[model samples]
Target: MKHQPHDAPPGDPDSALAGEAEGYLLARAHHDQARREAEDLCARMPWLTAAQAEDVARHYTRKRIDLTRQMLLSTVERASQLRQEYETRYAALRRDLLKLHAAGVCAALICLGGAGALASLLSR
Candidate 1:
């Protein structure tokens, strides 16, 4: 794959995908660098053939894949932690709201009783 960095400037119509485009360019550069190194190694060592160079590239690719997988797993773990914290805060707010509602109901009932008592005294 061929990719070049900074093809689209910031604020360009395609800038929204700049991060992904940059990643692709970086990955391509890394692969090309590795391939060149592998070729040089094969050239320096007469016994090592093209097949050995291919194997070296394959090994590096596998290492990169493993590292990406680890990063993704850690991200998932972080997301789970955030979700738990949000749930705890939501539950606390719900409890506080319920307490406030109960207090309001009690206050209304006390006022109604006081009004009824005042009316009876006035009638007598």
Candidate 2:
């Protein structure tokens, strides 16, 4: 599941509902994936007793879930860091662009003023 950053302001009911729904879906998907992995592991070692297999499946599932949670948290953290870095860079670029435009306007005005002064002197 792709994680999306929430855009709604705090205290918005719709955003809260959407967040809850997304959380539910993510949890369900993770559980389903862990179950499949556990089953696959059990299938590979069919000689084990039923009780032992069950125990092994439970342990494997727990570990898999924990690992997946850690990885997801790591990914989310990195995504946040990247977003901050990008936003900062974008702001700096916008500021530079504004400065360049202001400089160009000033240069154009200076050239026009110089031409006007030269024209007045020639007329005199």
Highest TM-score against the true fold, candidate: 2
Q: Which ten residues in a row have the lowest lDDT in candidate 1?
A: 1-10
Instruction: Write down the worst ten-residue block by lDDT for model 2.
Output: 1-10
Which residue runs of candidate 1 sit more than 4 Å off their true CA positions?
Answer: 1-49
Q: Alpha carbon lDDT of residue 30, candidate 1?
A: 67
Clashing residue pairs found in predicted model 1: none
TM-score of 1: 0.57
TM-score of each: 0.57, 0.84
Q: What shift in Å separates residue 118 of candidate 1 from its native position after superposition?
A: 1.7
| lDDT tens per residue, model 2, 1-124 | 3334467677777777787889999899989889888988998998998998889999998999899889989998999899999999999999999999999999999999999999999999
